[model samples]
Target: MHVFEGLEQRIQFMVLEVAKQVDETLRVLISPDEANIEKVTSRDDYIDNFKSVIENACFSRLHGQSHLDKAGIDFIRAVNIISNNLERISDFSVDIARQVQYLSDQRFLDQFEYRPFFRQILGALDIVVRALFHRDLSLALRICRAEFILDKLYKHNFDKIITRLQTGKEAQNLITTLFIFRYLERMGDSLLNIGEAVIFSVVGEKLKINQYQALRDSLDSLGVDLPLREVDFESIWGTRSGCRIGKVSGDNKGDSTGVIFKEGKHKKIFQEKINIHEWETILPGLTPKVFGFQESRGNASILLEFLTGCTFQEIVFNEDKEFFEDAFFLVQETAAMIWQKTLKAQPVPCSFIAQLSKRIEDVFVTHPEFNTPQVQFCNLMIPSTSELLEQLQQVELEVTAPFTVFIHGDYNSNNILYNQKEQRIHYIDVHRSTHGDYVQDVSVFLVSNFRLPIFDRIVRCKLNQVSLHYLHFARQFAQEYHDTTFEIRLALGLIRSFITSTRFELNEEFAGSMFIRGVYLMELVLAHQGRPWEAFRLPDRILRYRYY
Candidate 1:
């Protein structure tokens, strides 16, 4: 066989070998078959070697075929990616087999009905091989679609595991099985990436096909002047939030209009609409001019004005000391400006504490991992969810505001846009915007600044200083409004937002550090329970609690 043909055949052989692993894993999953365990486990070495061989073959071909074009190189690299993903599939299969081999029982619980998934994945492998060989975009599309199906199955099985946890079933067995399911689910993701690589190779350009389709449909529905295909769609990263955000802009007769596109669940998108309209009415020009909204396929996207300016965070963190000092004052003044607008507006009829109580309930249900001390967060201790709820209830939230005020539920620096030239602030990603305690927005703003991923001691110190100034700004608003609950309620809001946030973040050091702050605030709320609300103080530094 020719060198190129040999490489292609090797890629096929690698996937087929991975198919065997998944096939054997199914037998082990259904029944503790020792031979299936042995077969899958022993082949891990071979699979690893196969990956190395395929990778080296691709590179060697590139080196030998000096006349190869970029397309030829891309084909080689795509095959390499596929081989790597297939090897991972084998590794996961071996992990599953090892779990089964160590099982003391002859039968494992099939609560997830995982046998069909094995068949599905094996089928996916077959299709992937064909797609790679022929560069068949249709087969690649099918593989991508299979990932969605696999995700649904994974969620169904994950919820089953959580339900088992609620029932107080066998912990060790359930945890191990949970890890196995995680492996299977990750295999699905790796396969998805492989399929995407196929599409990338075929298209000769990069775009998340699903989102590109959604964005195109969105611009079409809006009847925007930009041509559907020509509209540049670039994925924007949300490092701190779970929103699939993008920026789409185009030229119409040399007049370009930029719009931000955000996609998320139906409810979140719906809330964003309400919040945007609320700001439009009460605090006009304080948010981007929302162009339109669309919902379909259990997801929603919105297009709005993409304001041009640095984030308040960028201004605050800029290296110029004078700029930082000036920006610090300006940020606080802006906070005061926005807080005052809501101080007189009609509230959403939901009390902040009542809303907080519901969120605390969600925290308990979603983040039950924090229930056990063995979870090992920071050294600072936290109360059980139940106990924390009880302590939270003891605080008095009835403040003497003339009435409720519209509050930005997520007032983080990243969410708020600043135009230094225009001296205006615009809010985006306002899904959580609701009418609640001014203190709720205030507390969120404070913690949002606090939780930023900055580690420089001096920068952190300055950021904390700015946060304290912002809080003092909020307190001034509170004192003027005759609202007495700012201090304690801020603590409660921090606890609710921070502890619940643990589920979204996976970084141990960052998450653990945040957990410590949450626990510290929780303990303070419990200690000063029934005391004067103003007597408590928000900490100047998050790391200070680390010494405890």
Candidate 2:
């Protein structure tokens, strides 16, 4: 039987109950009779009971014997969310009705246009059943827009109440009236949530209304001619950057390869768009081609050509020895070509410590124990996190890259994709691509590989080998370029990457290992401060995973 066979009618009944409560609450505001107040408050229990019953049914279907398709699952989820929000609206109505009791005069609310608030809320509520059941995008948009309109109404009434309160003529009445309007505004908020739940059901992804609109605008700007309801959105999780990334494809089309839709702060998305263009100029086909970009208010969205290939992380974990080696060779070759083409003979001061400082707070937020105080260990004085960073910052000023090259700001393994058939490597997230020290990329790449949580001995061994191989290649490049402080600079870069990388890792043993490696590197650099930097050696043991 249908996934939501019994549940859909119950949710519709619940919505109707909430709408009636709101209607009674509005009448109580217009004329606060005891009976109207009692009617609004007493029915809240029925609405609450309806919510429980619907919620239990939704969960039961979810955990039932029959398997549900993605659409069925999404519908159940949307139904549950919609029911919860409808219950909230009912509660808010009771709250509004209670506030009417404090009004010194019921007509005090009449001075303000409160009917439009009810009209907006009730009109939106009238469509909840139809919009959610039909999966109608236009109806969902209408429901979402009611929140914006109600917000405007609330603001207008709020200003009027503030002005009247300044007169001290009816301060209590004005405040009580404001409370009623606030509850109405909150009811509008519930409508927005209900509308977004419907959108989620239609799209099979949880997207805020603004994000959905941005995606639609981005697609329209590209002349994609696809409706929002007809598109499939598959969320790309595992990112800490607070950006919404998804793979979008036309649901009706079988041949669509899909495109990457990214939405975030305008500054970041815009910078990425600019950076992609720069990469195209420096090396065509190195980055994904931007299909369209749209910025509205403070947020932006971009549609990018989705690169079809396995990420470098996938190859390292799943591919055979020959395939992994071939991919690694391609990575090395790509780096060499990009660095050679974009190299600028200008000394850029190392900002490893500075970058570390920016993210150290985040590290401490995740692993507070990493922020230790100075400790005594035999004859040596171990530095605290702060003390180590301060010393590194002082020494970092003296070191600089002899030449600058365009580097991927985030050189993680997953960000680099390799297409075996075409034998090509493409960069996916190019927001941080710019002219900078090459060691930045090198250090980040090594740490990214080391930070993978794979514990299998064979995979870990491969990771260790690849990290050392890449390090050797970077050292060779530095030597050829005559970067005098290459070793010291790389040590600083590694220290920065290793320390910040721990913030994303939650495994205590693994995170502590990375943190200790960073501290050890710091001590090594600090000890060699007065000596010649070239003689300093990077211990490979710190990079390798050792079994106890």
Q: List TM-score per model, in order.
A: 0.59, 0.60
What lDDT does candidate 1 reach at residue 298?
71
> In model 2, which regions exceed 4 Å deviation?
1-255
Worst 10 residues of 1 by lDDT: 225-234
State each model's C-alpha RMSD to the native: 11.4, 15.2
- The 0-to-1 C-alpha lDDT of every candidate, in the order given, reads 0.65, 0.80
Residue 477 miss distance in model 1 (angstroms): 0.9
Instruction: Give candidate 1's total backbone clashes.
Output: 0
Residue 371 lDDT (model 2): 84
**Clashing residue pairs in candidate 1 (N, C-alpha, C atoms within 3 angstroms):** none
